[model samples]
Target chain A: MIELKNVTKQYPGQPHPAVDSLTLTVPEGEICVLVGPSGCGKSTTLRMINRMIEPSAGSITINGQSVMNNDPDHLRMGIGYVIQQIGLLPHRTIAENIAIVPRLYKWPKEKIVRRVDELLVMMGLDPEKTRSKYPSQLSGGQMQRVGVARAMAVDPPIMLMDEPFGAVDPIARTHLQDEFLRLQKEIRKTIVFVTHDINEAIKMGDKIAIFGEGKLVQFGTPEEVLTNPANEFVENFIGYDRIVKKLFLYQVQEAYRPAVCRLRPEEIGNALSKMLAEKAEVAFVLNEADKPCGYLTREELEQEETARDADGLQKLAARRSKAFVQTTTPLPDALSVMLEYDAEYVGVLKNGLLEGVMSFKDIRRHVYRREGE
Target chain B: MKMSWERFQIALFEKAPEAVLTHLLIVVITVALAILISVPLGVLLTRPRYRKFGVVALNILNILNAIPGMAVIALALPILGLGIKPAVVALLFQSLLPIVRNTIAGLLEVSADVKEAAAGMGMNQRQILLEVEMPLAMPIILSGIRTSTVYVVSVGTLAALIGAGGLGNMIIGGLALFMPEYLIVGAGLGAIMSIFFDRALSYLEYKITPPGVRAN
Candidate 1:
């Protein structure tokens, strides 16, 4: 556990402290994301944990031991740090970059080599291909991965990431975030993540600590911060779209309702009866493997001029656009696919098998229930 | 007085090799001493505590550099009194500026981000200098050494005025006797030495540069 009690950082000449007397505790194996607008002291708080920026007042302790007690170099070596500008040494090859902390610890040569390769693989890079390559040779996304790999070299118990994904393009940022979330499940280091984007905070943070003008305004789980913002600043910071952003926290499975009318492509004759029985405006079609291939609207089925396949069954329109989400996909992402395909509901799949559907109505119902609560 | 091939052969064969060796000695000793003094001074001046002194020290070096080589040798003659040692001391003064300036420039040119990363990785100040700063700054620093070396070789010919007995002795002897052969041998060898050292150090500079940094 990392705890800061009444910690403050005041620059020598500046009137306002960069970080005011603030207290926060991050429990073991949890990610505490520090978030705010620019110059709000989120980065200052992170640097203080590693003593890169010393706190002017109060104490910072990790696992009940004061951060100030140890030699600063020794203290920093035991903690992992990553930054917005992925700082890999230009002089070192990828393997050497990852080996820095381990070499500092004087690990055996064989052990260091093994650890370097292990980290590269863990970070999804091919060791043989990337080990000899220099930082300049790697793309931005690759360099960021190597930066994280280097930080994790010694398996430090605490890692501080200051907008680790902020430098990547949006598509790569999403991939990295998801990859890290998966990696965190197994590593479970106490982490203090800093980010400006609320959606990122909600997605990656086990708990979000909101800062404003060097003061920590609120610290709670994403659910708490979104549902019950502390004040006007938080409400505005969380934005008018807080209701929709909250959906990112929930998986498609949570809001899933079994699709009322499901038909195999060969079972198209029963589509009208199935929709009538369940009062569904649309009927989902599944293939022999039970994967959702398409859907049929009641208007299309009711039309006499509707096209049919060679088997005398009504043709499935919008066939196999992959308009489905895995059961584990976030509701916001699932909602995006719904919007993209212009559909009322998105089919939820488990291992390529159709499980159910989550509709716009289900999301609205979920939001209404939370708003009432 | 005629430019005779026989006299040229005599000058080249009889006196050329010894004068060339002595000239080489003056330049090599002067450049070596300059490097030893300048590199450490440069590193020290760049350190936070001593950084304020850097501007003062560099200005002094720049003034020393501005003094002509013959005048520096002439000034050294009174204090050290006529020898290869006095000549080397004079040339050493002339050589210090380039190495010192380049070393300071090289160390400063190491990007702030790279140094921050080094410190963030828990490298102490010493390690950052040895592991990161030095390697990255190497090519620039070596080019300074090259510049200093070539300047020293060209200037060592003036050492003969103080009886230092380098190729300058040959040139002075040829001037008094009006022999074109002696002048050609002395000046030619000096020019060739300057070119050799320049090319050699350039290769060294290229070789020592870290491969990743070479991409830039």
Candidate 2:
């Protein structure tokens, strides 16, 4: 665990301390998000942990050892740090940028190359295509991915990200956030994420630490902060859309009702019986690989034309299932897909197979009930 | 007395060779000295501790740069007396401005975001400067070096006034005796030398620039 005890940072010639006796603990493998408006000292607190900004008073310890005890550079190397600017070295190619820390630690050449390509692949970048390209050649999203890959080069247990997704457009930002959350599931690094966006905090943070005017207003799980805000400042900071924001806290996996039956395209007769027997409006169509290709509604199946050709059902379902989301996707994302397709229910997939479906009605009940609590 | 092809050929092949060699030597030494002194000084001035002094240093270089070359050569004669050494010293002063100014500007021009990322990634100050800052600043720095080299070659002709015995010697002699052949020979070789250095360094600058930076 990383713990800060009464940590304070006071700058000279400044009337108020940047951080005032702030104390918090980030349990191992949890993402603790520090969020507040500009100049609130959330970024200051993060810098202190890495010794980028030293505390004027109090102590910071990682697993019981004071950060002051170790060499600053040595301490930093073991902690991964990413910034909003996506600071990949412009002069270095993607491979060399990722290899920086490994080379510094004196890892063997072959091992570093292997690790570089492995990281590129892990970031969902084509290793062969992206490895030799420079930062300028890649798009903003790709550069951000490379930045994260560079930080994780040493596989540091703790990653510090300062608005890491803040620079990209909203669409790319969401994609990056989802990809990172999925990666975190496997790595489970203790992460301190700083941002000004409440929805991002809710989506990415395991524990949200809210700050106001250089003081931490509240620190708890996203649900706790949303339900039981410590004071007026936090309540206002979370804004008037707290109900909609709460949708971000729950995943599709949690809120989705499991599908009653999923049938292959060739199972026309079976699909008809399943829809009628369950009295469901829609039934998901799965391909040979068991992946949801699309859905056939009761109206469409009843038309008789769609069911006549077994091969025609496959051709009809070729729209690529726009109204589908992975099980880990946040409810708000699922809602977006539903709205985008103008559908009431969104298909939730687990490992590309149809696991269930979540409807707009389901999210209302889930979020409203949680809001009441 | 008259403009003769035979006299021009003699100036080109026989007397011109020694003057060209001397001119090349003075330009080479002066440019080398300017680079050696200016590059490190420029880097030092850009350091956080020394950044405050950067303006003062640049202003001083700017002042030295404003001085006329011949006047500088003449001013050097009173202090160090007349010779190739004094000529070189004067040319060296004239050359320092471009290199030092460009080095500082180039290093400063490196993106702050890139530097912050380097530090955040655990690179020490030295590593950041050598690995990140220098390579990025190289194209600008080389352009500065290129400017200084060409400037030094053109100005080395003035060193002949201090008895440096360069292409300037031939030009001065031709001017006094009114020999157009000597004038053309000296001026042509000097212009050729300047253009050659400029083109060669431009090529080097292009070759060394990172592809990412080049794209920009």
Cα lDDT for residue B112, candidate 2: 94
Model 2 alpha-carbon drift over 4 Å, by segment: A252-330, A333-365
The prediction achieving the highest DockQ against the true structure is 1
lDDT of 1 by residue, A192-300 (tens): 9999998899999999999999999999999989999999999999999988888888888888887557887667777777788888877788777766677777766
Interface RMSD of each: 0.8, 0.7
The Cα error of candidate 2 at residue B211, in Å, is: 1.3
What DockQ, between 0 and 1, does each candidate earn? Answer: 0.72, 0.63
lDDT of 1 by residue, B1-216 (tens): 689998899889989999998998888888889989999998998899999999999999999999999899999988999899999999999899999999999999988877877788899999999998888888998999999999888888889999999889888999989998999998888888899999999989888988998955
Q: What would the per-residue lDDT of candidate 2 be over residues B37-58, giving only the tens digit for each residue? A: 9999999999989999999988
**What lDDT does each candidate get?**
0.89, 0.89
> Comparing only chain A of model 2 with the true chain A, what is the TM-score?
0.80
